[model samples]
Target: MNSSPPLSNLLRLAAAMIIITLSVYWMIFLRGLLVPILISVLLSILVSPITIQLEEKGLSKIASIILTIVLFLGLIAGIIYFATMQISDMLDVWPDLKRKGTLWFTQLQNWAYRLFGLRPQSQITKLQEMSMAFLSGGGSAALLKTTSTLADVILIPLYMFFMLYYRSFFCEFVYKVMAKSEKQRVNTVLFRICDVVHNYLSGLFIVMVIVGSLNTISLLILDINYAVFFGFFAALLLLIPYIGVLIGSLLPILMAFITKDSPMYGVGVAGAFLFIQFLEGNFITPYIVGSKISINPLVAIIGLLLGGVIWGIAGMMLSLPMIAILKVVFDHSESLKPFGYLIGEPVREESRRVVEEHTAENPELITDEVADSVKEAI
Candidate 1:
């Protein structure tokens, strides 16, 4: 009888795992259509506060949606234009860059030979050949890829606008779908999710600006070319977790080594980025983004890697927010509350604050004895 129960439980667990795996695979397969919609949903959440503020200040729902989207698109357009200019400037010096790049490649080969007793030329040549084949050998494949990208660009904004416009209807639908007894708890979750997203985005912007400015100042002190662009570029790459900063720092260091008269400037670039990243990882992000999401670095990196495995780059981009949303959901459900607590930062005062807020919001949620018990526990 004991063996029978254990076997049954194992089978059930295996089935659940299979189902979850298949569901994720299906989502990835449907990403062509789903990614844009998902991106729009996230963008809508980020801009919801602005939409609400505009509505409060006398704009109609449609008008507010249009304005918010326009502003959002304008920012994107600005970035595109800036990047285009930078690319044009780069192309103007491509011949010089190509020569310098060849020199750097030779140095890299020598360094590899000295360090690993391996020739990098064959590997580099193979990579170059593969890249050329992928880019140039594709006729219909290239055309289809371009068409899909254009479609996504158009559809994402349209979806974002519609999502923003239908925000109220969506909320109503959510409320309607749940039981009356669960409505308060659902609303609480909704409010908390919004707060988390809004604060996370706001804090992200501030951190980016702060980091970018610091990078610019440091690069300026080192007399690096296009310091502003490189600074902001490094800051922007921070949107990707784990390996992003290193990749961002590599480009500027390479540029500094190739373009500057002294190789020491490259060292300075590396040092600057390392210090900035250390400050950001240790202090800026912890205090700002962590304050909103309350997710630790270890959990975030694991979630990011898992999401990337499931959904590729889109999965990685969505992972942190998705985890935060899951945490909110888990915390509210009695059965899942332990998982929620496991994901959250280890801070007892935060729980006490949450309890105090819960009591304030729903005063009759607990009896006097229960409240006293909570106080004592806190």
Candidate 2:
């Protein structure tokens, strides 16, 4: 009988594993369809306040949503224009940059040969081969990829429009479908999800602007070419976790190495970016974004890896916010509250302070007599 119980448990575990595998496969298969929808939903939530404000100002619902979308598009266009101008300036100097880069590469190759006995000709040959391979294979693939992206870009605004238009219908549908007892809980969860998404998106944008400005000012001070481009490029890459800033910093460092007379300029560039990165991680993000999307590092990293596996870069960008929304839902659910806690930032200082202040007033509250109260406060 005991063996039967163990065997049954094993089967149940296997079943769960199978279901999870299938779910992952399904998501991968539907990625093209899903990415736009997910982006649209986030965009809708981000602009919900604008829509609401417009409605309050006596604009019709449809008109409000339309104006909000137009304003959003205009903002996106302005950013694109700014980036394009920066790119154009770089393109104008591309030939000179390439010549300098080639000269630097030749010098590095000679240095490598002297230090490590590596053949410089072999390095050049490999580089030529790789360039040839990319030229042969990348063109058609690039064109098709661009076409696919354009389709998604077109679909996203349409999705956002419908989603906004039917937002009320969806909320009503949820309430209508749920049991009366659960309606209150569902309503709370829906609001929490909206709030989390809105705050996270808005706060992230503000942080990006602040980080980008800092990056630009630092690079300009360093007299780096394409300072504005590199700065905001790095800021945009902040959407990716961990390595984004590193990639961002490397470009300017490479520029320093190519254009500047001294290697110390490269070192200076690296130092500047590292300092900005430190500020962004420690002071900037924490202060601006706050604890609204307070995902612990471990959980956030794991979610990011999983997201990358499922949907590449877009998935990675979406993962943290999605995890935050999930945590909110989990926190409100009796059965899943533990999982929410597991995902959350660990033992926040504010929570600790609350506990200490409460205990000072009533030390008995911390004792076994009221352990649940202590736990709740934490």
Candidate 3:
């Protein structure tokens, strides 16, 4: 009793698929130039207020850009210096740590061997071999192999400087390209993009600073060695989302266990990081970086997977912001509204409808169909 999908519908679907594939291909291909530019644009947006302030105070555009870049580099250099100093101090005690680790690992291995009577080492060996193969390959070669994109991320500053310096020209060009009637829409889109990007990046950094300070103070109270190192590193890892949660918690817990005699210290370290993450996720993020990036989990996960395919880990890191940017673009454009809806988090009626339809049949079987229908409904 069902009719076949319309020929027009089929053609449109085919066309959309082709466009998406080609777009991804181009992204992967041109990533060398695009990646740096993208990073620079994000940086410029984050710091534009400062640049504008400087310009207002009588600094030339070039001078303002130079000063901003200099300040940025100085901040980076200071962090690198402190991190290196902490690492050196840690390395000074690495021998003792190594002994502790080796002894524990061997005991675990022996117990596992006796209990399981299976060769886990072969699998572990395979993993080691793969890791070594990846490491032994040069960084650039590895980058090219994995991402098919540029190896060097070092040029991001250069791109950022030029972008910031020429930002006005670019803005003018954008205005010139559009009809006067569309100017308001264009400006609205631009403002939304800038606000999302700036708020997202700036708020993320602020969260890192707050979380890192809280962690360091907690570790210091517990008298953990390398407290600053572990705390800051763990805090920074929150940038990676779910994977960040596991690794961030593990790093400090492992250090506490090794360096302190009490098992409670390990528990304390784990609890602190977990508690901080919970607070950040539930409380802090909402205030600072909330609805600006209200992407649904489904959309975000898909972006991460596709990003991994096209650009590997770097792509994964950038995926959320990119999706957020895309959502803004989609919202403003009439033709692309469906796409905006598709990629965005199901906020109201959308999520409710998906749930209702999903439960009517085998909920599990109908999930993807519900999602597709929702997208079509958009």
| lDDT digits (tens) for residues 206-304 of candidate 2 | 888888899989889989998888998998888887668888888989999999888888999899889989998998887766556778889999999
Write model 1 residue lDDT over 1-378, tens digit each, in one string: 344567878899999899998988888788788878877887889998899999999999999989999999999899889978987888899899889878877787888888887778776887798888877775437677678779999999899888888888998888988766488888988888887877777788788889888898999999987888888898987777766677778878988988876789999999999999999989998777766677756788898998788666667877888888888888788888888877877685477668878887888878778976885454
Question: Residue 187 of model 3: what lDDT?
Answer: 88
lDDT accuracy of residue 345 in candidate 1: 73
All candidates: TM-score = 0.85, 0.89, 0.82
Off by more than 4 A, model 2? 1-8, 128-140, 349-378
Better of 1 and 3 by lDDT: 1
How does each model score on lDDT? Answer: 0.83, 0.86, 0.79
lDDT of 3 by residue, 1-378 (tens): 879998999999999899999998899998676766777788889888888899999999989988988898899889889999999998898999998777656665677778977466864796698888778875537555545343444577777788898887988888888766388888888898998899899988988888888889988998888888888888887667656666877877888777666679989888887888888888887777775676777888888888778876667778888899998898778888888877766664376456656666565666776665754343
Candidate order by decreasing TM-score: 2, 1, 3
Superposed on all Cα atoms, the candidates' RMSDs to the truth, in angstroms, are 4.6, 4.2, 8.6
Error of 2 at 23 (Å): 1.2
Model 3 steric clash pairs: 296-345
Instruction: Choose 1 or 3, whichever is better by TM-score.
Output: 1
